[model samples]
Target: MAVIGSVAEFTAEEDWEEYCERLEQYFLANNIKDTETEKRRRAVFLSVTGGKTYELLKTLLAPQKPTENTYEELWQVLQNHLSPKPVVIAGWYWFWTVRQKAGQSVSQYLAELRRLAEKCQFGNFLNDALRDMFVIGLLDTAVQKKLLSETQLTLDKAYHVAMSHESAVQQVEEIQGASKQQVNKVKEHRDPQKEKGVISAEGHPMSQMIVSFEKSCVSRVVTRAM
Candidate 1:
């Protein structure tokens, strides 16, 4: 069996058949006996082939490359075997692209993704959307609450790291709010006359109102003069 020439290029139906045969042979040679592995392997193969076919169809549809009839034929071929994971694939592709820009290795990303998935209680498709922010962060929290709200997941645990972190954040916000309220209360309690520069009980026009009010003041002045 011949492997498809350059998976990045489109192959004829006969070539695709040969490619599948070759892939099966390779898998068998590796002693791939797990049924789940086989199923996922086939799914991945189809998804990749469908993507390649779609790319080729796009190329053929470009101006001056192929006629409308040829484009329609290729489009039909693409539409026939399109896989269900298109949205997942697109998100993963974008994630990888961004990871590349951020200089993060794919292995590290996958490890972090798996960690997040386990943390979020993702049983199915846990490994699939492990790295997706929407999947593991808030969405995971929401899902856990929906399914297990009446159980341990329902009640917030003080020991849970995520909940602890959230609690800390909330505490800081509450303290800040309380501090602001205190400041506002102080401002509200301040005398309006003092705020407007009019002296009250302390002294009116304090600078000029000085009288011989006390023997202590006279003694301090006498000592200073001496």
Candidate 2:
């Protein structure tokens, strides 16, 4: 039999929702079945969550023992302790105030918007809220204008348009930067005066011209003398 993947122990700094998601995936991968009462699953969770986490869970449960609880009850207890639901108004305040930060990409901004929106409890209007926030929060005025100009714009469409615009802008900058570098290299290799006339062995253009003229005069005088 192949070795099953292991789950990492949860830490205080980690997001409880994300950690639970990964834990569920690990359970699925290992083919650990949860009985109707979730006994097996509950036992596995307690064993795999590490000593410190189990101790924390015991503390959260208080007078109740860990073995007395179902898996769902255990999960809920830990979740509520670690990640209590935020107040709706406070969540909205953050969601409304968020903007695309400097040096942050469109994708990163979108992820932040989603994270903040989770607490907002937008429900059915989630997509609409996300779309509006995404457009207004954009740092690029051109991309914002493009999104606003669209008729009946959905969140999906807006995301596609914004990403496309971001990609195109990056490509143009790269191309222009490369072209400028090539032009500079060519300029460095070329000497305008040398192209027009030969430089003197002494490496001066005016001196070369003067020397040629003097040589010409001397040759004519010598021919006349002859």
Candidate 3:
């Protein structure tokens, strides 16, 4: 809610006051126990914006060059000094923190994405992640049992791993009564198998061996990426 931007030059006089009010409201909205830590974070956030928000304010505020990191240097300072961190760490922080406060529902995050898409950077990632998380909740048993079985738990997972994916969600269908569409979607996004041709030492076809080899390569890629 804190409208971080330059003070003396960039922000309009009225907008600065509005930003301060929003910042206060945002902190109150969180209701977290770390009031003291949050205060320090907020202070750093304000200090940075008050000084640096103007350097690029003309470009950011102008219609032609609305760049996202209008306060990049300030953000660096806040991330370094704050504990529990302020909502200025990354472009995604505002949406992520708001999701945290709103019970961490997939629906809630999606709602935020809808709002953010018009104004925020990395909007694509947030929307994609939220949709994927919902699809996973629909199909995966472990996901359902661990996160979705309960409202709050599901909400929490929605916030933390809204963008996470399980590699095998696609191929198998009908896992605990999930929709076929969901399964198909997972399969659609996942990487296709790159089959290494199966040939025995004698130059005979070895279909099973080829399948095994491809699976091994895919597994290794996934493991290393993780």
Report clash pairs, candidate 2: none
Query: Could you give candidate 3's per-residue lDDT for residues 47-123 as a string of tens digits?
Result: 54554453444333455332333334434433343322324345345434443233354445456555644334444
Who wins the TM-score comparison? 2
- TM-scores, all candidates, are 0.25, 0.76, 0.22
Q: Which stretches of candidate 2 lie over 4 Å from their true place?
A: 1-3, 29-32, 192-226
User: Regarding lDDT, does 2 or 3 come out ahead?
Assistant: 2
Better candidate number, 1 or 2, judged by TM-score? 2
Ordered by TM-score, highest first, the candidates read 2, 1, 3
Per-residue lDDT of model 1, residues 51-143, tens digit only: 555456556456533233332354344445542224544555554343221434334444555543433444575534442432233322433
**Tell me, what's the RMSD of every candidate?**
21.5, 15.3, 17.4
With a 3 Å backbone cut-off (N, CA, C), the pairs that clash in candidate 1 are: none
Write one digit per residue (lDDT tens) for candidate 2, span 1-226: 4738888788878898998998888777877655753787898889888898899988988899898998889999998988898899999999999999998998999999999999998999999999999999999897788788889999898888878777766655565565456545554656677654654233444444544655565555434422
C-alpha lDDT of candidate 1 relative to the true structure? 0.43
Residue 58 of model 3: what lDDT?
A: 35
| Candidate 1 Cα errors over 4 Å, as ranges | 1-91, 95-160, 192-226
